[model samples]
Target: MSNVELTNMCMIYDRTNNRVLVQERVKSWKGIAFPGGHVEDGESIVESTIREIKEETGLTISELEPCGIIYRFNDQTGDKYFVFNYRTETFSGELLEETDEGRVFWINREELLELKLSDGFKERLPMFFDRKFSEGFGTWNEHNISELKFR
Candidate 1:
Protein backbone atom coordinates (compact mmCIF):
# COMPACT_ATOMS: atom_id res chain seq x y z
CA MET A 1 0.00 0.00 0.00
CA SER A 2 1.16 3.54 -0.82
CA ASN A 3 0.24 6.88 0.75
CA VAL A 4 0.85 10.56 0.11
CA GLU A 5 1.89 13.82 1.76
CA LEU A 6 0.76 17.31 0.81
CA THR A 7 2.30 20.74 0.36
CA ASN A 8 0.92 24.08 -0.84
CA MET A 9 2.53 26.90 -2.80
CA CYS A 10 2.29 29.53 -5.55
CA MET A 11 4.14 29.78 -8.88
CA ILE A 12 4.73 33.45 -9.66
CA TYR A 13 5.73 34.28 -13.20
CA ASP A 14 7.25 37.66 -14.00
CA ARG A 15 4.92 39.14 -16.57
CA THR A 16 7.49 41.61 -17.78
CA ASN A 17 10.35 39.19 -18.35
CA ASN A 18 8.70 35.83 -18.80
CA ARG A 19 10.78 34.56 -15.91
CA VAL A 20 9.69 32.80 -12.78
CA LEU A 21 10.51 33.77 -9.19
CA VAL A 22 12.49 31.43 -6.97
CA GLN A 23 14.65 31.44 -3.87
CA GLU A 24 17.92 29.68 -3.25
CA ARG A 25 18.15 28.24 0.22
CA VAL A 26 21.34 29.21 2.04
CA LYS A 27 21.56 26.11 4.19
CA SER A 28 22.70 22.56 3.53
CA TRP A 29 20.88 21.72 0.33
CA LYS A 30 21.73 25.10 -1.18
CA GLY A 31 19.07 24.72 -3.84
CA ILE A 32 16.56 26.99 -5.56
CA ALA A 33 12.82 26.71 -5.24
CA PHE A 34 9.59 28.71 -5.50
CA PRO A 35 8.52 31.35 -2.95
CA GLY A 36 5.74 29.50 -1.20
CA GLY A 37 5.46 26.87 1.51
CA HIS A 38 3.26 24.44 3.42
CA VAL A 39 -0.38 25.36 3.92
CA GLU A 40 -1.21 26.57 7.39
CA ASP A 41 -4.10 25.35 9.45
CA GLY A 42 -7.37 27.07 8.61
CA GLU A 43 -5.94 28.36 5.34
CA SER A 44 -6.90 27.38 1.83
CA ILE A 45 -4.32 26.68 -0.89
CA VAL A 46 -5.01 30.14 -2.30
CA GLU A 47 -4.53 31.74 1.11
CA SER A 48 -1.29 29.90 1.79
CA THR A 49 0.21 30.72 -1.61
CA ILE A 50 -0.68 34.40 -1.24
CA ARG A 51 0.71 34.58 2.27
CA GLU A 52 3.88 32.72 1.31
CA ILE A 53 4.42 34.96 -1.67
CA LYS A 54 4.12 38.04 0.52
CA GLU A 55 6.44 36.63 3.14
CA GLU A 56 9.09 35.39 0.73
CA THR A 57 8.82 37.96 -2.05
CA GLY A 58 7.63 40.96 -0.04
CA LEU A 59 4.82 41.37 -2.54
CA THR A 60 1.11 40.83 -2.66
CA ILE A 61 -0.50 38.53 -5.18
CA SER A 62 -3.42 40.76 -6.07
CA GLU A 63 -4.87 38.79 -8.95
CA LEU A 64 -4.19 35.09 -8.92
CA GLU A 65 -5.22 32.75 -11.70
CA PRO A 66 -5.95 29.16 -10.89
CA CYS A 67 -3.36 27.40 -12.98
CA GLY A 68 -3.88 23.80 -11.93
CA ILE A 69 -3.13 21.13 -9.37
CA ILE A 70 -0.42 18.42 -9.33
CA TYR A 71 0.59 15.32 -7.46
CA ARG A 72 4.23 14.20 -7.41
CA PHE A 73 5.25 10.71 -6.38
CA ASN A 74 8.80 9.81 -5.52
CA ASP A 75 10.27 6.92 -7.43
CA GLN A 76 12.70 6.07 -4.69
CA THR A 77 10.40 5.95 -1.67
CA GLY A 78 7.03 5.82 -3.32
CA ASP A 79 6.01 8.90 -1.26
CA LYS A 80 4.03 11.77 -2.75
CA TYR A 81 2.88 15.39 -2.45
CA PHE A 82 -0.34 17.09 -3.44
CA VAL A 83 0.67 20.35 -5.14
CA PHE A 84 -1.56 23.30 -5.84
CA ASN A 85 0.03 25.47 -8.50
CA TYR A 86 -1.36 28.92 -9.33
CA ARG A 87 -0.58 31.77 -11.69
CA THR A 88 -0.20 35.27 -10.31
CA GLU A 89 -1.21 37.58 -13.14
CA THR A 90 -1.29 40.80 -11.12
CA PHE A 91 0.59 41.87 -8.05
CA SER A 92 2.36 44.69 -6.18
CA GLY A 93 5.34 45.29 -3.91
CA GLU A 94 9.09 44.69 -4.11
CA LEU A 95 10.50 41.21 -3.58
CA LEU A 96 12.77 40.68 -0.59
CA GLU A 97 14.04 37.86 1.58
CA GLU A 98 11.55 37.60 4.43
CA THR A 99 12.43 34.12 5.66
CA ASP A 100 15.25 31.64 6.14
CA GLU A 101 14.31 29.90 2.92
CA GLY A 102 16.96 31.91 1.01
CA ARG A 103 17.57 34.79 -1.39
CA VAL A 104 15.26 35.15 -4.38
CA PHE A 105 15.88 35.47 -8.08
CA TRP A 106 13.86 35.63 -11.30
CA ILE A 107 14.92 32.90 -13.69
CA ASN A 108 14.16 32.58 -17.37
CA ARG A 109 12.39 29.53 -18.71
CA GLU A 110 15.59 28.00 -20.01
CA GLU A 111 17.58 28.90 -16.91
CA LEU A 112 15.06 27.10 -14.77
CA LEU A 113 16.20 23.85 -16.30
CA GLU A 114 19.73 24.15 -14.91
CA LEU A 115 19.18 25.33 -11.37
CA LYS A 116 19.37 22.78 -8.59
CA LEU A 117 15.82 22.72 -7.27
CA SER A 118 13.41 20.43 -5.59
CA ASP A 119 13.32 17.80 -8.31
CA GLY A 120 9.56 17.69 -8.01
CA PHE A 121 9.10 21.29 -9.12
CA LYS A 122 11.54 21.05 -12.01
CA GLU A 123 9.66 18.06 -13.33
CA ARG A 124 6.24 19.63 -12.88
CA LEU A 125 6.75 23.27 -13.91
CA PRO A 126 6.65 22.62 -17.64
CA MET A 127 2.92 22.05 -17.57
CA PHE A 128 2.40 25.56 -16.23
CA PHE A 129 4.15 27.07 -19.23
CA ASP A 130 1.98 24.94 -21.49
CA ARG A 131 -1.21 26.34 -19.92
CA LYS A 132 -2.43 22.99 -18.68
CA PHE A 133 -4.58 24.52 -15.98
CA SER A 134 -6.76 21.62 -15.08
CA GLU A 135 -9.16 21.68 -12.12
CA GLY A 136 -8.52 18.90 -9.61
CA PHE A 137 -5.88 17.71 -7.22
CA GLY A 138 -2.68 16.46 -8.87
CA THR A 139 -1.51 13.02 -7.94
CA TRP A 140 2.24 12.46 -8.01
CA ASN A 141 2.91 8.81 -7.38
CA GLU A 142 6.08 7.78 -9.15
CA HIS A 143 8.19 10.66 -10.38
CA ASN A 144 5.48 10.84 -12.99
CA ILE A 145 3.60 14.19 -13.12
CA SER A 146 0.71 14.45 -15.52
CA GLU A 147 -0.69 17.88 -16.41
CA LEU A 148 -4.37 17.05 -16.25
CA LYS A 149 -3.91 13.79 -14.40
CA PHE A 150 -5.64 13.58 -11.06
CA ARG A 151 -6.31 10.88 -8.52
Candidate 2:
Protein backbone atom coordinates (compact mmCIF):
# COMPACT_ATOMS: atom_id res chain seq x y z
CA MET A 1 0.00 0.00 0.00
CA SER A 2 2.65 2.48 0.94
CA ASN A 3 6.15 2.90 -0.44
CA VAL A 4 8.99 1.78 1.75
CA GLU A 5 11.13 4.47 3.26
CA LEU A 6 14.21 4.68 1.02
CA THR A 7 17.67 5.92 2.00
CA ASN A 8 20.18 7.56 -0.38
CA MET A 9 23.53 6.76 1.22
CA CYS A 10 26.56 8.79 0.13
CA MET A 11 29.73 6.78 -0.53
CA ILE A 12 32.46 9.34 -1.16
CA TYR A 13 35.87 8.55 -2.59
CA ASP A 14 39.00 9.98 -4.21
CA ARG A 15 40.91 7.23 -5.97
CA THR A 16 43.73 9.50 -7.12
CA ASN A 17 44.51 10.15 -3.47
CA ASN A 18 43.41 6.66 -2.39
CA ARG A 19 40.90 7.96 0.15
CA VAL A 20 37.29 7.56 1.21
CA LEU A 21 35.03 8.99 3.89
CA VAL A 22 33.10 6.98 6.44
CA GLN A 23 31.36 7.43 9.77
CA GLU A 24 31.39 5.29 12.87
CA ARG A 25 27.88 4.38 13.87
CA VAL A 26 26.66 4.89 17.39
CA LYS A 27 26.78 2.03 19.91
CA SER A 28 23.45 0.62 18.72
CA TRP A 29 24.66 0.34 15.14
CA LYS A 30 28.06 -1.17 15.95
CA GLY A 31 29.59 -0.46 12.51
CA ILE A 32 30.90 2.27 10.23
CA ALA A 33 28.58 3.82 7.63
CA PHE A 34 28.62 6.17 4.67
CA PRO A 35 27.31 9.68 5.45
CA GLY A 36 23.72 9.94 4.29
CA GLY A 37 20.07 9.72 5.30
CA HIS A 38 16.56 10.09 3.89
CA VAL A 39 15.92 12.07 0.75
CA GLU A 40 13.84 15.03 1.86
CA ASP A 41 10.78 16.21 -0.02
CA GLY A 42 11.29 19.11 -2.45
CA GLU A 43 14.93 18.06 -2.89
CA SER A 44 16.66 15.98 -5.55
CA ILE A 45 19.07 13.13 -4.74
CA VAL A 46 21.98 15.47 -5.46
CA GLU A 47 20.49 18.11 -3.21
CA SER A 48 20.03 15.54 -0.48
CA THR A 49 23.65 14.49 -0.82
CA ILE A 50 24.84 18.06 -0.42
CA ARG A 51 22.58 18.61 2.57
CA GLU A 52 23.53 15.29 4.15
CA ILE A 53 27.25 15.90 3.65
CA LYS A 54 26.93 19.25 5.38
CA GLU A 55 24.78 17.88 8.19
CA GLU A 56 26.72 14.69 8.88
CA THR A 57 30.32 15.79 8.36
CA GLY A 58 29.83 19.51 7.91
CA LEU A 59 31.61 19.26 4.57
CA THR A 60 30.47 20.80 1.31
CA ILE A 61 31.27 18.69 -1.73
CA SER A 62 32.89 20.95 -4.30
CA GLU A 63 33.01 18.35 -7.05
CA LEU A 64 30.78 15.29 -6.70
CA GLU A 65 30.67 12.53 -9.32
CA PRO A 66 28.12 9.77 -9.03
CA CYS A 67 29.70 6.34 -9.16
CA GLY A 68 26.70 4.02 -8.87
CA ILE A 69 23.55 3.00 -7.08
CA ILE A 70 23.50 0.11 -4.64
CA TYR A 71 20.86 -2.00 -2.99
CA ARG A 72 21.45 -2.35 0.71
CA PHE A 73 19.23 -5.30 1.59
CA ASN A 74 17.64 -5.49 4.96
CA ASP A 75 19.09 -7.87 7.52
CA GLN A 76 15.69 -9.38 8.21
CA THR A 77 13.44 -9.78 5.16
CA GLY A 78 12.38 -8.62 1.70
CA ASP A 79 13.10 -4.98 2.46
CA LYS A 80 15.96 -3.21 0.66
CA TYR A 81 18.35 -0.29 1.00
CA PHE A 82 18.74 2.07 -1.97
CA VAL A 83 22.10 3.81 -1.85
CA PHE A 84 23.66 6.36 -4.17
CA ASN A 85 27.45 6.18 -4.24
CA TYR A 86 29.19 9.36 -5.31
CA ARG A 87 32.81 10.46 -5.74
CA THR A 88 34.10 13.79 -4.60
CA GLU A 89 37.52 15.22 -5.31
CA THR A 90 37.28 18.06 -2.81
CA PHE A 91 35.36 19.03 0.28
CA SER A 92 35.53 22.14 2.45
CA GLY A 93 33.77 22.63 5.79
CA GLU A 94 34.10 22.16 9.49
CA LEU A 95 33.06 18.73 10.84
CA LEU A 96 30.24 18.87 13.34
CA GLU A 97 27.41 16.78 14.78
CA GLU A 98 24.15 18.15 13.45
CA THR A 99 22.44 14.76 13.48
CA ASP A 100 22.58 11.46 15.41
CA GLU A 101 24.04 9.55 12.38
CA GLY A 102 27.56 8.76 13.68
CA ARG A 103 31.16 9.89 14.14
CA VAL A 104 32.81 10.92 10.86
CA PHE A 105 36.27 9.96 9.63
CA TRP A 106 38.25 10.16 6.37
CA ILE A 107 40.42 7.14 5.83
CA ASN A 108 42.56 5.78 2.99
CA ARG A 109 41.31 2.93 0.79
CA GLU A 110 43.58 0.38 2.41
CA GLU A 111 41.87 1.00 5.75
CA LEU A 112 38.20 0.61 4.78
CA LEU A 113 38.10 -3.20 5.07
CA GLU A 114 39.66 -2.94 8.52
CA LEU A 115 36.86 -0.76 9.82
CA LYS A 116 33.62 -2.36 10.98
CA LEU A 117 31.77 -1.26 7.87
CA SER A 118 28.04 -1.68 7.46
CA ASP A 119 26.82 -5.15 6.44
CA GLY A 120 26.50 -4.69 2.67
CA PHE A 121 29.08 -1.96 2.11
CA LYS A 122 31.93 -4.40 1.55
CA GLU A 123 30.09 -6.00 -1.37
CA ARG A 124 29.23 -2.64 -2.91
CA LEU A 125 32.48 -0.65 -2.53
CA PRO A 126 34.53 -2.19 -5.34
CA MET A 127 32.38 -0.58 -8.01
CA PHE A 128 33.34 2.86 -6.77
CA PHE A 129 37.04 2.08 -6.97
CA ASP A 130 36.58 0.90 -10.56
CA ARG A 131 34.94 4.20 -11.52
CA LYS A 132 31.72 2.39 -12.47
CA PHE A 133 28.91 4.87 -12.10
CA SER A 134 25.62 3.54 -13.41
CA GLU A 135 22.22 2.17 -12.46
CA GLY A 136 22.42 -1.11 -10.64
CA PHE A 137 21.95 -2.84 -7.31
CA GLY A 138 23.78 -5.55 -5.33
CA THR A 139 22.19 -8.28 -3.27
CA TRP A 140 23.40 -11.20 -1.21
CA ASN A 141 23.09 -14.64 -2.78
CA GLU A 142 21.30 -16.86 -0.34
CA HIS A 143 22.20 -20.02 -2.22
CA ASN A 144 25.32 -21.20 -3.99
CA ILE A 145 23.37 -22.12 -7.12
CA SER A 146 22.45 -18.50 -7.89
CA GLU A 147 25.72 -17.00 -6.83
CA LEU A 148 26.65 -15.70 -10.26
CA LYS A 149 23.18 -14.76 -11.46
CA PHE A 150 21.85 -11.23 -11.25
CA ARG A 151 18.38 -11.23 -9.79
- Best-fitting candidate, measured by lDDT? 1
Task: Go through the candidates in order and give each one's C-alpha lDDT.
Answer: 0.68, 0.67
lDDT of 1 by residue, 1-151 (tens): 6555555566687768888887886653357776667777778778888887888788899667766666655556677667677777577788785467788877896788798886455645655676644634433344465444432
- In candidate 2, position 116 carries an lDDT of 81
- Tens digit of per-residue lDDT, candidate 2, span 73-93: 433455565666676767777
Worst 10 residues of 1 by lDDT: 133-142
The list of candidate 1 runs beyond 4 A from truth reads 1-6, 26-30, 72-80, 133-151
Clashing pairs in 2: 67-133
| Per-model TM-score versus the true fold | 0.71, 0.74
Worst 10 residues of 2 by lDDT: 142-151
- Residue 36 lDDT in model 2? 76
